[model samples]
Target: MKQKTIYLIRHGETDYNRQGVVQGSGVDSDLNAMGQAQALAFYQAYQHIPFSKVYTSKLRRTRQSVQCFIEAGIPHESYEGLNEISWGAREGKMPNNFDNEYYSTLIKNWAAGHTDYPTEDGESPDQVAQRQKPVIDLLLSRADENPILICMHGRAIRILLSWLMDESLATMDMYEHSNLCLYKLQYDYDTRRFTIEVANDSTHLLALVMHH
Candidate 1:
């Protein structure tokens, strides 16, 4: 009955993130200056945790954010499952008034529990859930008695957490994560369950904010 833990981290900010553009599965983007700072802070904050494995998305932003952990001598793995949702045609496109309206309507439908609402070339909420479930299961199964660190995009993290917690995608939308935010989940082998210890904690970011 050994305990297991999973540390879920959202990658730092990107240029597109700052610009409020949809980055979907377009060409990978690197972190901005603030994002680099946040990633470094994340490393400093959790250096003592002794993570058994570090996982990150294939996207550049997530990989870069966790690069500090690799430099610190932690072994890590990357998975495409951890990548953000594909925005299809909207990838890297700056949203105009019309685009904003369309995106907002899509989001509103999703928020109202319409998981199957089709996006022109984007994945629906249910589709995201389906894709992430296998990855979540794999991570959970491998976390027998060790702690794992997962670095991924914001939307991916949210969808995975929603599935893990058995909450609806609509309800999960209420939770927002800032760049490099860290979330902790502890699992009880005896009960075969996991509980969230912390959600979207950005204490390290706050400290960096205060310092600068």
Candidate 2:
């Protein structure tokens, strides 16, 4: 039985994130200064791991989160499949009281068996899950001893984990993804199963907080 490991990460914060604005697939925001520090901190901590490949979403934030590794000559590929879910009319909107209330109601509806229901022109949870298929498939097909690193958005990470665990996407809200947090999963080729080794871990960023 061979074991394959995967490191999953959520992209660091963007200016939109700092400003309490919605940054979905359509927004395409870059990492802010704090975000850059978070990325560097993550890299400095995990550089010891010999990552065979790197994967990221087409968005700038995901790629920027791993920019250090990419610049260090580590090979990587971008996939649109890993992009964040669209928030439609709220894509780049800074949340006001009304926006906040509306967003909450929207999420409430989605959780109430309306997963396919969209807010404005935004994507439904089902649509996000659909695009995540290829990313999941690629992970399952990898050979043992190959360690892959992936950087994507918060919602997308939750969707990927839900799919991998064979759980409902509605339950994805249970997983909390902080900036630069990581999850580690080990796949056993023999049993054809994935066992989570780490979840929502941000211990590596403790030292970096003083600077931020």
Best by TM-score: 2
Distance from true position, residue 129, model 2, in Å?
A: 0.8
lDDT of 2 by residue, 133-201 (tens): 977677668674279899999888887787677787777777789988999998888987778899999
For candidate 2, give the lDDT of residue 26: 95
lDDT per residue for candidate 1 within 70-178, as digits (tens), equals 9888888888877888767788988899998888898888788897776777787688788777777787778553888989887777777777777888776766788
Clash tally for model 1:
0
Candidate 2 wrong stretches, greater than 4 Å: none
| Count of steric clashes across candidates, in order | 0, 0
User: What is candidate 1's CA lDDT for residue 133?
Assistant: 71
Question: Which pairs clash in the backbone of model 2?
Answer: none
Q: Give each model's whole-structure lDDT.
A: 0.83, 0.86
How big is the positional error of residue 181 in model 2, measured in Å on the Cα after superposition? Answer: 0.6
Candidate closest to the true structure, highest lDDT: 2
Candidate 1 clash pair list = none
